[model samples]
Target: MTKPVGMEVAVAAAEAVALCNIDVAACYPITPNTHIAEHLADIIADGRIDAEYITVESEHSALSAVMGASGTGARTFTATSSQGLMYMHEILPITPAMRLPVVMGLGNRAVSGPINIWNDHSDIIMQRDSGWLSIFADNGQEAVDMFIQAFKIAEHPDVLLPINVNMDGFQLTHVVEPIVFPTQAQVNKFLPPYKPFASLHPDHPLSMGTLGLPEIYTEAVKARDVATVNAKKVIVQIWQEWEKQFGRKYEPVMTYKTAGAEILILTMGSMGETAEVAVDALRKKGVKVGLLKLKLWRPFPFDEIRKAVRGAKTLVVTDRALSYGGPGGPVCSEIRAALYDQPNRPEIVNYIIGLGGRDVRVEDFMKMIEGAPKAKKSGDAYQIYGVRE
Candidate 1:
């Protein structure tokens, strides 16, 4: 039986992982993400879930341990945030290259320099090309739901790759909401026991993660690239299956009031809800504005993006992370590139907002939308919202 209960998003995420019957959880303590690892430890300590919680020395070791466990065919899980994720940078690319289907819960936070701990997309954005299937959750419900769906998507025979379920640090992670949890039987039915395509066993001896010489290095990387792109099919299939059973539909690009609108506001992560409120207010005032929330970050969702912005004249793209020295933001740059060859593409106005846990209010969204027309052109530059003079 599925039950709805008010819970903190971090706890709810840990609960979702517990329901998946993961075999090993090796996570280090990091801000915003610590609660998840702590709760997982409690669950294992309480014997609620028969899983091994490996205590590691650092975030690097945390990922390394999970990799070894996953290589041994264990259903592995891990969680991290901010610098912790950066610490795992070396292992990030290796995991996908080795085709390990490890699932991780990323509490999205700002990367350090002056040392701040808060909500932002900078952390995850740093690993954009690491070849992990990244998905963002707009709220607590989506966070819980995506964690459960991640295993199925990653372990699919067609897509044996790692996945990162991203939720805003402090914004989505620490907040409490009414999250619906599927029953153990329901989870079991949806996600059967993970059957590894290959494993490290003594009897069936086979080499894994062997050195890639110069001759085959290009082909090796090409194979991984193709695999990442093709994983979209399995991801959608798993999402559809989840909807069929749980009644919550998910798509790569989730739209709100986009029909027949000439202007669209694009956002990712938890700010989508805030943008939705702005959209409703603008619509009430007879503005033809809509909201497009990106859920699937990697593999880029090119077709859905093209379809969503088809008739819009202007697209206001809000990015939480700034792409230094390059385009205004990573997402805005990608959106421009995706629509470059399209027939009638909209003018993109990029704004890097809510960096380092800055609050982005509904009125701020409204101001951005209202002021977008007068803002600089698509390639001119990006505006940093709410910066003090």
Candidate 2:
């Protein structure tokens, strides 16, 4: 399978982390993730890819030089977006409580004020609790297969978090598709090299970002929320072994025909491809509707979004970014808290739509799925969509 046509899903995400043999990149550039660190510093200056790029300056020293070259184990990676991910919001909780499986590429932007660039997700939605394993890609072949399955579920020794691979601004990083660049012998028989169960050893040296009080700081933040809820079962067993070596099955939450739908839209990056042509033109004008697509926003799948809006009667969602006064934004307040304990739950409708890079076309998701029956019975928490005076 070969198909790297006109490239630039940020150089097919630095050629899929140099075919997953990454060994320290530590970058510093933010755009659309600065053309994926300028095409991985020209594939580490044409040595063909041995790694060790490290051109740091600021996104907090490019995540403090990939948390000090992934704490001397080194299989790191980097890329940023929007105010350089809020200027690395204080080492994004010290690279997953110093676990350091640092694989990033969050080119989704739109987090300025009164001054704008493009796309949105409020810069990885303010690092949603900074444990970082946020994924969200809706194009460019799921942002080069979620940066190679977010470094095999963030260096999975039972998930050592710190994986963020969003894609949006300039729509999937200067949008050019037909990806499939997998074979470096199938990404070296599916990503191997990183073997640091625990690192930084000048002969057994440790002591990283310490200072835990309050009786071991609530068991070190409950072992980083049980390693981010055991990364939802180790990201479904590394996405079922990356769908048996890249057949692709990415469903940390994705649905299309919402079962027996009576309308369900919801969305994520690239407006879920303009809500998949507004769910096939409102299902060829018959309009039963269905969509949902949120490829993992933090550890918030919420049981596959409560079984894809459980027999929907109206779902909607659709936020781009806006939580200022706070009503509906961060993925429609996590899809209204995953259907607020659904007992026949449906009637949800947020809709803030395509800010800054605003042009959510396809007839603005087919006039918001043909007004989803009066904006889901108008119990509004939102409904902004291409706002004006």
Candidate 3:
């Protein structure tokens, strides 16, 4: 059994990638995300992992290189942050359309305008419609475990799609934590060598990512959508297998102290951990408050969310990214749509918080929970927490 070791989450994620024995990693350095690629490069340089580390010029080139490599049946990996992710936007949809299972470690960061280098969901939320399976980690251990599981889910025969394992920029990436690194043998058992369902080889030449003419463009898009929605089954199956092998269970929607609760707060990423503390404190004070942490983002877990929010009188949905001129935050909008038709659906209140790595303490979560009822009564779509006039 491998013992827990003190390691930075970024390095631990690199180690996890190494354990998977990927064929190639196309990387470009960006803040917070740089450490992951740097460590992976060091591992490759030291001959610890026999993988090709391609130092690309930009995030666009990095993803493009991985797409080309993955097309040739290579188990490809990559990492990027806010603006870097934006650079790869052009090729993002193409990778999934071609059914390439390239796994990416997205160091979640704020998008640039004011040029902030901090943690937020803005980067990942922007790519929500990119047709990739996206999952979030609340801590370092989850980050490591999710990286290992990502490849398996992406490379599954029934689900040949790319995936993004998102970890908060500085919050989770730069922090040191005691993480249990699974032995290479254990990882090998959990995630076997990736076997591509199709490959671009001269021996048996086939076309991929070709122009979808007006004749079949809609059909082609529909097919990709079907494949993405269908991937949830394979994703769950892989997660269950990982749990059986490693004893760490993962679910789409995770609940805390939710039994008999009248009000619940919903969150994603690392903020869930802070919300749990608030839930415990409120529970001790005879308040009926629970917490829901969403792990799976793409192919959103509609059923699981409805079940979790059932019987609750109110749900305070927190968003780390804003929707700008839209209804509210992207997350709040999705939750509202998910619970719209359900009978006896709880009142969903939206609170935008923790953008650009702003500190969201336990008191903040407590305040949200305590103030949810009034917020719902006010009839406002959403409120940005801690915003100054």
Candidate 4:
């Protein structure tokens, strides 16, 4: 086991990418995510890793360049957040449709019309149906471990889909924490060199992201959907391997203190850790409140979620992003859909919180849990937590 050392989470992400021995990194600077690319550039420049670092003028160009590099059989990486992710949306779906196994580090931030640079899942949620697998990191170790696992999952022959590893902007990104930087030998054992399923070559030319006619378009989309949904198998296999190598295990839906909890609050991203505090406090007062965290977002782990929330009477799901005019947050909506057919599903409560860097505390989680039953009985769909009167 490598000794733990204090490092910024973004730097550790760069280090994780370096350890994967990526061949190219296309980078453009953007708020909260710039450090990742900057550190990667430094890694390449300092000879810590052998990679061609391409500095692009915008996030669109950055991801486009990375996509092209991956098309050429190069293991590529890039980082972006908020508006940067939005700017790259045009090419986002193309990556997975072409089956390019590019990995990205997403500094999860709120997209802006008024321009705010803080932590939220809005940017990532907007790209949810873009055919990319999404994973959330709750802390520094998770950020590092998931990135290392992502390349393996994305490059696997059965998957060959791009993945975005999301770290909450400013919350997890800017924090300096003690993280275990595994040795090159350890990483090499965990992550084999990336092997592209297909490559763009002049000698062996292939068409990618081609126009689909009305008759073929639907089938092509179905093919991508099948590939993405099936990616969960590879994700699980990779996580299992990561566990064996590092003694750290990750699941699609992870739980804490749900043994006999009547009320459970579900969360995603870094908020899970904060909610743990409330879970502990509530358990102390003899309130059967537990916490459930969704680590994997894409291909929506339906069975795992259904299994995790089993036997709970009330489920309070907290989302960091809003759907605006919709029923509730993205997570709560998905959870409801997943549990729709269950014979004994809990009464789900949806809460939208922490948008545009809004602070949410342990007490807030407790209140949400306490208010869930009333919200359910009142026939309200969901409530925006901490909204001003």
Q: Once superposed on the true structure, which residue ranges of model 4 sit more than 4 Å away at CA? A: none
Error of 1 at 10 (Å): 0.4
Local accuracy of candidate 4 as per-residue lDDT tens digits, 177-261: 8899888898888888777777889999887668889999899988889999999988998888888888988999989999999
Residue pairs with backbone atoms closer than 3 Å in model 4 (clashes): none
RMSD, each candidate, Å? 1.0, 17.8, 0.8, 1.0
Whole-model lDDT, model 2: 0.81
* Selected candidate, larger lDDT, 2 vs 3: 3
Per-model TM against the reference: 0.99, 0.36, 0.99, 0.98
Query: Of 1 and 4, which scores higher on TM-score?
Result: 1
Error of 4 at 40 (Å): 0.7
Off by over 4 Å in 1: 377-379
Scored against the true structure, residue 326 in model 2 reaches a CA lDDT of 81
Q: Candidate 3, residues 307-367: lDDT per residue as tens digits?
A: 9999999999999999889999999898999999998999888999999999999999999
Tens-digit lDDT track of model 2 for 1-389: 67657677888888888888787787777777788888888988898978778777788887898888888888888888888889889889889897788998878888888668788777778778888888888888778877888888888888887888888878778878777777888777777767788788889988777888888988988888888887888887777888887778888778876667788887887678777877887787888888888888878878888877777777778878778788677788877777787788887778888777877888888888788678767776887876886
RMSD of 4: 1.0
Q: Estimate candidate 1's alpha-carbon lDDT, on a 0 to 1 scale.
A: 0.94
